[model samples]
Target: MKLLKLVPDDTNIDFMKWRKIAFGISLALMIASVVLVGVRGLNFGVDFVGGQMIRVTFTQTAEAPVAKLRDTVGALGYGSPSIQRFGAPNEVSIRMRLPKEAEGQTGAAATMTNAIVGSIQKDYPGARVDGVDSVSGKVSDELFQKGTIALLAAMVAIAIYIWVRFEWQFGVGGLAALAHDVTLTFGFFALTQLEFDLNIIAALLTIIGYSLNDTIVVYDRIRENLKKYRKMEIGELINLSINETLSRTVMTSLTMVIVLVAMLLLGPETIFGFTAAMTLGIVVGTYSSIYWGAPILVWLKVGPDSFVPVGDKPGAPGRDREGYTR
Candidate 1:
C-alpha cells in the first residue's frame, strides 16, 4: 500500500519567487504589531501588575458559587473580583485588583487578601483557601523587567548559535524570523487585552523554541543544498531546500495545531490564554520558518560559493555535476 504523503516526493515550490511579497507583509505586520503594543498595551495579569490571587476549593460542593462569591467579595469593598474555575468544578482562582493605596505596600495587600479569605471561609464552611499570592508593585515591576530580559536574551543567543552552526547570513535570517514571531505574539496580546503574565512569558519562550527548531531544520537543508548544488541559483536552491523539508514541517505543525485547537475549544479557562498564545505562535512560527527564514538568505547574497573555499574553482575535480564530492 502506498504511504500517505502530505508533501509529495517531487515537491518543487518556488517559495523564493514571492520573497518580496512575504517580506513586505512581514514588515507591515511587524510595524502594526509594534504600534498596537505601544498604543493599546498589554493587559498585564496579577503576576506583572501588583495584585492578589487567591485559590479556593469547596470540598463539599460540585461547583463554586461564582455569582455569590463575586457579590460577597464586592461587598467587602475590595472591588469586584475576577473569578474563574480552574481545575475541578469546585475550585477557582479569584483575582483581586490592588487598590491605589495598597500599591507597593505588601502588608496592605496581604491584609486585604487575608480579609477576603476570612470572609469566604465564614460564609461557606466548605470553602478552603488553598493558596494566596500577594505581589507588590515593586516586585511586579521587577518581574516584568526580568521577563523582558529573558525573552531578548533567548532570541539573541539563538541567533548567535545559528551563526556559529551555519553562517552569519543564516543567523540574521533566524533572528528576523524570531522577531517576527514574537512581535506578532505581543501584538495578539495587545489586541485581545488578555492578561499578560509569567505564564504567557513561558508561552512566548516556547514559541521562540518552536520557531528556532523549524528554522534550523530549513537552514540545515539549505546549507546541505548549497554544497551539493553549486550550479543552482540561490533562489531556486532555497526553494528546493524548503520543499524538501515541507513534509516534516507540515506534519509537525499540523499535529501541533490540531492539539492546540482542541485545547482552545475544550480546555480549561485557566490555560485559555496560554493555549491561545501558543496556537498563534505555532502558526506564526511555521510561516516565518518557510517565508522569512529561507528567503532572507537569497537577499543576503548567500550562494553555493559561500560553502566553498576561497580558492576553490567551479566544478572542481572529484565533485559531481551538482558540485559536492561523490
Candidate 2:
C-alpha cells in the first residue's frame, strides 16, 4: 500500500532562490520590533516590574469576578490594580504597582497585602488570600538581568554545540537562524504588547532549541550530501539537502503548530502569553531553518573541502581518487 504524504517525498524546491527577499523581510521586521521595544516598551508583569501579586480564592462562585475585583481594588485608591482570573474560575490574581510611599519601606509589601485582603474581606465574607508575593525594584532588576543572561547563555551553548558537530560555517549559519527566530519571536511580543515575564523567557529558550534542532537536521543532510555528491556545487548541494528534509521539517512544524494553537485557544489566560510566544516561535523557527540557515553556508564560502577529512587528499597513498582509504 502506498503511504499518504502531506508533502511529496521527491519534491524539488528552490528554497535558496528567494534568500534575498526573505532576508530583507526578516531585517525589516526585526528593525520594527526593536523600535517598538524602544518606543512603547514591554508590558512587563509584576514579577519583573517590582510589584505585589496576590492570589485569592472565593468560597462561592462570583459573577464577573474580574470586573468586580478590579473595581474593588480600584475603589481602595490603589491606582487601578490589575485583576484577572488566576487559574480556576473561583481564583483571581490581583497585581498592583508599588506605591511611591511604599518604596523601600520595610514590610511594605506585607502591609499592603494585609490592607488589600482586609478590605476585600468586608465584601466577601469567606474570601481568603491564597498566596502573596512581592518583588522589590532591586530584586526585579536582578531577575531581569539573570533572565537576559540565561537567554544569551543558551544561544551561545547552541552555537558551540553546532560548531562541534558540524563545520564552523554550519555553526555560524545555525546560530544566525536561531537568532533570526528569536528576534522575530520577540518582535511578535513587542508588536502585540504581550506580557514579558519569566514564562515568556522559557518560551524563547524553547524556540532556540526547536530552531536549532531543525537547523541541525538540515545540516546533517547537507553533510551527508557533501560526502555523496562531491561534484555538486555548494548551492546545489544545499538546495538538495533542504528539499530532502523539507517533508520532515514541514510535518514537525505543522504538528507543533497544531498543538500550540489548541493550547492558545483552550488554555487559560495565565498561559496565554507563553502559548502566543511559542506559536510565533514555531512558525519563525521553521522559516529560519529553511531559508536563513542554509543560505548562510553559501555566503560563508562552504564547500566539499569543509567536510572532507584532513590529510585525505585525492589519490594520496592508499586513498582512492574519491579520498577513501583502500
TM-score for all predictions?
Answer: 0.85, 0.85
TM-score of 2: 0.85
lDDT of 1 by residue, 26-109 (tens): 899999999999999998877778798899999879999887888898899967577888799999899887876776664778
Candidate 1 colliding pairs: none
Q: Which residue segments of model 1 deviate by more than 4 Å?
A: 62-93, 99-119, 311-326
How far does residue 305 in candidate 1 sit from its true spot (Å)?
1.4
lDDT of 2 by residue, 91-121 (tens): 8888886776777788877777778899888
Model 2 gets an lDDT of 0.83
Which 10-residue span in candidate 2 carries the lowest summed lDDT? 317-326
TM-score of 1: 0.85
